[model samples]
Target: MMKCKINLNPKMLNLLFLISYVLFVFSLFNRDVSDIDVFYSFTIFAKYISLVLLLIGILAGTYTRKEILWFIVLLCIDFILFIKSGVLVFIIISLFAFHSTKIEDDKIIKLAYFTLLIFTVITFLLLSLGIFNDALTNRWVGDSERHTLGFYHSNVLPLIYSYLVGYGLSSGIYKKNHYMFLIIINFAIYYLCGSRNVLVATLLLIGSKWLIDSFLQKSEFKKMINNILCVFAKIIIPFLSMISLIVPLLMNHIGFFQKLDFILSYRFTAIYKIIQTEGIHIIAQMTNEMYFDNKIVIDNGYAFLAIRYGIVMLIFLSAIIYCIANKYSDNTFVLILIIIVACINFIDNDIIDYSCLPYLIIGEKYVLESFKRRGNNYE
Candidate 1:
């Protein structure tokens, strides 16, 4: 097997990752500038430049054969789908995954947390100045104005803020201090964004943690739960990918499902429309046209993947997530964090977001190493 032996500076690589991450986050916020063309041009330029820096850092680092193979497969799929951004981001993530075994996980995580903290502060300042009012006003939030902290839309802001809350809680737990301030800030952002899905995800994460610790205190119960989850984890990717196909069919037959769809702001309707128009296939053809009537966005991440890349690609992507989740199953912090992210992906486009990809890859790498260590011990 060809082994990666590149010895890149850890600090430099961390710095590059931080910069790339920040730029990627910034690119998501669709600022309402007077010059529309200039705004798009600048955003695109910043995005690609950031990707280039991350790619350079990745190339300078070590990689394994498995990482290279996965990268090639994903790159081919992205090319077929004509998703240039996804291709670049996945390559960077693959490199990170391959090199994660050689680097300090805590250091990379701390840098990411620090970057998020700085970005949140700046966003708070901008929100205070009323600079994001125009964008806020443009969002469809049922008569009431919703603040987004200068993001492109209100729905996505809470999901982004959840990361801050997660990092803050993680830091507080590590330092042995309850971070009430972080929770307060997260609640404030949640209120501003008015996204019920984000609120549910945040509450579920916290509630689930407390429940696991308090209710599942017995070792036997814990072991049983872990065993069950391990079995589910192995098949979760393909199962969920197949389920996505069945959802639209159920919506058509069930009245309660339609009402449930309405509660989720017609997400089901949009998904159903896409399936009806596009027709479910092994590999979907790339199209620039909107799938739904009157330009309704695909809010559900699974549905989006199914529409754009088809079930095969969705299975591949979900398998990647499953690997990450499965590897980190032993660590409560990592396991819960992955669950929280996966839950949020149900209602948002976070599955392919830049903020979560690095961590997923890193976690997968950690697990892979653990397996190798076990094999060596056995031998």
Candidate 2:
């Protein structure tokens, strides 16, 4: 990654905004996540942009030995996920292109900014239009059983988008903008989307970023954060596990007696059933119906890999998280993004784990390094 002073053109800047818009729109009407409308059209165009990225990397990576290795390992994971998850690869690719604009020109940064903004605007509009006129989420996206504007309530969109706005305003092209305004806008979107997980994720992201920034400004912050994480990693979850298991589920059903035997609840039952389905394909069918129903969808990233892919892939994922867990720094916005996304994976099941976006993050910074490397050669 080369760094120098550069800017993106307005049109290109807007592309990032539109990409976010497309992602939100894609989530709205289609329960299956395979349907597309005008939103993802640019996603089709951005595939070329990814090729351009590789071309640039090949030309300049003569000295970016580390990056080249990371890129190869990344591409291999990308290929496997594509085969396993279907169209999600495109979303990752598009995000890569969008986030790749940093260390470029002002125009390029603006392009990424506008792309996110377009998403923000379109998502709000989708909900508002539905509310005001009593229309569906997207006109093109017709009826569905889930929580679309006129559909289903997956409860994760608001969290993801809200974190996105936080990522941008916190360290984005819009860093100068009011963080409160950015958060409020996304929170409104969360309400309209009706996703509690997103709300929790957004709060955690903001709190984590603020706390880390404040404490880490002092020399002791890193030690403090590590200590806290270590404690939570060990002591807290274990003590809470029994409480979590003992939790009385709230059910809106007939007869208090039937509901009170909460020990016979779906979750406890699901645990036993998960054990039972070890040798058969029926679990897949059961999981399909449970896709976005708060509890199942918002399990750990590890569980998501198992449920969606397989136990083998889940092991690969554990190894990847282990590698990333210690390697990355928490001082940057990317670090915050990683923390939030990783936490979301613990519960939200729909995401692509071990994604390709890290390459995009690298490229954004690397472009500057590329320029620096160029400058050094000249010197």
Candidate 3:
């Protein structure tokens, strides 16, 4: 018997991955396109093609035992959830893309930032010309209304703008480049979107990074502070995890929490209602019932995941993120990016989008690299 063999060029595969990722990002804007049927079909086709290319890469690439084990575990959880096959495929593709790609992380970061910058510029130009005004809506803040540029809803623009800001800051900080212009552009867009949460989150993320970096520069205090932080992180992370799991249940009875929820646009209240009325099994199936008679919207990403993919899947994902963070503890850029995204997720369901897959893929690649280093050291 002859063994079947297939070979793929790493460069070609990487190029294909980049192209597919760009297409996927473009597809996100398809929501605003009027001819939904044709555009939606094209978007779906682009996604499937990306998945196919990623599948091929996975077949041709080598994976560590740790990677394979986690992949199988996630696949099992996905099978149980069973509603969003596209999401499952996305997870698998991300894992494989991380394993198979030959591009350097810095290059990938630059590409992503460049792409976002282009999109922001183009969108701004279009908005200036009065294009997409039909899709624009007003976002209420206190007693006034603000414009949301070129988005069907006010929530989406802020999420998108925050991502750009996060990536811009990450790249700028890492490269030690002057990114003030990029930050300004992102802030202007966020302001126009009328998302106070996004503005606050972006500033907090940037400020947090700056503070950490400044503190670490103090040679005498650096080591001691690092040790203290590590210990605190160990305790606080698990505590926070438990808090997240129970926050929905608590939102119903807690008066102070109810007021806070109302301030945050009733996001927690809506999620609590969904879980209470629909049961946890609602996560195992995809439905629009979370809209609460097509009136309420659950904007929290964690809540969306818990309701759309089940508690088990959500826990699994949280664990995966925890593992990645633990593995890449020294990479401040990755850590900051994750933290920013987590903050944004509290206000929007951006995690469910295809754009987030690249970050996960990059983190997974780091995990695989760590595994290889461990094996090498043991040998």
Q: What TM-score goes with each of the models?
A: 0.77, 0.52, 0.78
Compose the digit string of candidate 3's lDDT tens values, residues 126-198: 6677664535455444544556565466656666666766666666634224445545755785656667787
lDDT of each prediction vs. the true structure? 0.61, 0.43, 0.59
Candidate 1 local lDDT, 29-94, one digit each (tens) = 334222234356767777777778767776776555664565555456656655522235544455
Local distance difference test, candidate 3? 0.59
Ten contiguous residues minimizing lDDT sum, candidate 3: 232-241
- Candidate 3 local lDDT, residue 187: 79
lDDT of 2 by residue, 161-253 (tens): 654555454444443235466568567766565555567667666666566555565655576566445433323322322322233222223
TM-score of 3: 0.78
After superposition, which runs of candidate 3 have C-alpha atoms over 4 Å from their true positions?
1-4, 32-38, 62-76, 83-103, 122-131, 134-136, 140-142, 173-179, 212-215, 224-245, 281-283, 287-296, 364-379
Ranking by TM-score: 3, 1, 2
Candidate 2 regions off by >4 Å? Answer: 1-114, 125-157, 169-179, 182-193, 212-216, 219-222, 226-300, 319-340, 353-379
Which pairs of residues clash in candidate 3, taking residues 3 or more apart in a chain or in different chains? Answer: none
Highest-lDDT candidate: 1
Against the hidden true structure, what lDDT does model 1 obtain? 0.61
**Clash count, candidate 3:** 0
Q: What's the C-alpha lDDT at position 327 in model 3?
A: 58
Top of the candidates by TM-score: 3
